[model samples]
Target: MNETNDMAVARAARLDTATLSDALDRLGIVGQCHKIKGRDPEFRMAGRAFTLLCGPASTPPGTVGDFIDDVPPGAVIVIDNGGREDATIWGDILTEIAHRRGIAGTVIDGINRDVHLCRTLGYPVFSKDHWMRTGKDRVQVERTECVVNIGGARVAPGDLMRGDPDGVVVIPRAHEEAVLAAAEEIHAAEEHIREACRGGMRLDEARRQFKYHQLQTRQ
Candidate 1:
């Protein structure tokens, strides 16, 4: 697809995890939204994807920069750091460069640093925790462009990632169009349910009337 077409597709598909979760009930990929708690309660980022694979006690010097340099302007970086809370995989300096490049936000299955800086820079980052210690000592890149785990979800390079203060969700590239369609439907249904509740319908009655139970029954 051309740049314009790509942008349009991305725009249509981009959504916060809550919307996505409501839609694709079976596809929920869970992770803590630790980095966003004290900051903006709502956050959004749009892009295709560029994934990173890092591990505890593993990244080489310059690895983070090299990976960021290679990522395209409108791609999200999914960093898999094995959920290590001791070291931070991303920091203020990297956030600065990423913003300059117009890169989409980051999703780290690990910890991050410079939380205040990230918030000020308006960069969306989702992580498991926050720490002052850097990754320099405990983490290094074991592989790039390789499959990595984010809360048990197998994320690959080029997959679609949508994250917000709610959480993060990974949309496989092959199923992007289908998943987005589902997410849209899910969001609409949720709105309908919300309206019902506001109209004084009982919670269980509204849920049942809206077929909310079906959301969990998808095979």
Candidate 2:
């Protein structure tokens, strides 16, 4: 990653999903990935998105996860599998390779298998759920570097993706700076309120002083 993009990702990593979600709401952007969460509560990932789309297996069955080798380091693999849970699009093999390659992490709109391995290797994997069933003949790669729907969020290639224990959020590359600024302001306000409360100020007074109620209101 270039210095500019790397700095952006670092800035985003400092903020959690909730703050970023509020920032998106304040900016009128639908970047929250609903119903998608980390397989392990301790998992967190922040990086540029390397997007891919998946569909039902082909007549003769096509490949699954073969494009992983092409993904660059420090990029989060965002896979949209139509939220299918009957089969898994990820497994131990993918997790091990991703960890070895220094890939940021993986986020799936559907489910994954071998989640235990993910926790063991500390390879973050966020998805709707996990199952042991293989996606070998049930799912196939449809497109790479394409616009894909993750949860209810639209993720295009190279979008900024950040996930914490709560869930994943995508910040569009075009509006990332604005979103980041908004999140930073909100974070600072909240921190100020906390400091005031620690100094014996009433919670309500602190909130009022910081305009906490208006922080997430659309601008």
Candidate 3:
């Protein structure tokens, strides 16, 4: 990652999903990945998105993860399987390769399998859920390095993706600086409020002093 990208990732890692969501809301941006969640609440990831769109298999079916070989290090694999839950598009083999290659993480609008490997390897996998069923012969890759729908959010190649215990959010490449600025501001304000409360200031007074209620309101 370049210095700018590294800085963005670091800034995002310090802010939770809620703060980022509020930042997006303040900017009138739609970024929350609805219904998509982190498999392990303790795990967090931030990186540019490497998107893949999937659909029902063709007559002979198609590959699910051949694209892994091309994914750059530090890029989060964002897979859009049309929210299908019957099968999984990610598993142990992919997890191992991704980990070894220094890939940031994986997020799916559908599901994943062999979650044990993910947890054991300390790799982060965010998705709708997980199942043991395989996606092979059931799901096929439609396109790669393209815009893909994740939950209700549109994720494009190189878009910033951040996830934590709360969930995932995608920041458009064009809006990274603005979004990060907003989120950092919100985080600072929240920290001030917290410190005030800890120092014996009444919650209501502290919140009122900082205009807390308006922090997340559309601006």
Candidate 4:
């Protein structure tokens, strides 16, 4: 809705992707960014999506990342490169610019290079993988601020994305409130179960008391 609302949602979705994934499953909503992984295992990110679609290079070979100038701060740059592993659509220069601009992070269906800068700056970049080959002549920007598929998840403008050591997950703008609520409930139940166990309750008893097994079951 607004920047304040987005930040609040982002903060609530801070739970690791695993917990959010369980919440999505419980709600029967598909938001997991399957096969996409963070470049650095410890890297973390959360922000609204600013999608970019990429296709095979055209006759004139369109630009690789001039769109950087247009991305708003606190928005994640989501690039859909058709999962091409041979060429990378992101690199150091873009990472530098994104970090300077306070952009949240970058997620790609393809690959990225110049990761040293990302690692150095703590600018999280998640993708299928990374490679040295540039996409300058192999791919081009097809569009921006439109829906794009990352990994297997469809991301639209303003959709919330959260990433961690586990992986990335997209919360459809329309489902953000529901997903966040579910995840919070699940997290609290888990904490209760742990506390019960620590207080000498049997693991099975704790789980049953907390409904641990059903936390992720489809409702």
The model with the greatest lDDT is 2
Enumerate clash totals for all models, in the order shown: 5, 0, 0, 0
lDDT values for all models = 0.70, 0.96, 0.93, 0.90
* TM-score against truth, every candidate: 0.82, 0.99, 0.98, 0.97
For candidate 1, give the lDDT.
0.70
Give the runs in model 1 whose Cα sits over 4 Å from its true position.
Answer: 1-14, 27-40, 56-62, 196-205
* Tens digits of lDDT, candidate 1, 17-43: 766655455445332233333234555
Tell me, what's the RMSD of every candidate? 3.4, 0.6, 0.9, 1.2
Model 2, runs deviating above 4 Å: none
Residue 116 local lDDT, model 4: 91
In angstroms, how far off is 127's CA in candidate 1?
A: 0.8
User: Model 4 reaches what TM-score against the true structure?
Assistant: 0.97
> Could you give me the TM-score of model 1 versus the true structure?
0.82
- Residue 148 in model 1: lDDT: 75
Residue 65, candidate 4: Cα error in Å is 0.4
lDDT of 2 by residue, 3-114 (tens): 9899999999999999999999999999999999999999999999999999999999999889989999999999999999999999999999999999999999999999
Q: Assess the local accuracy of residue 183 in candidate 4 as a C-alpha lDDT between 0 and 100.
A: 92
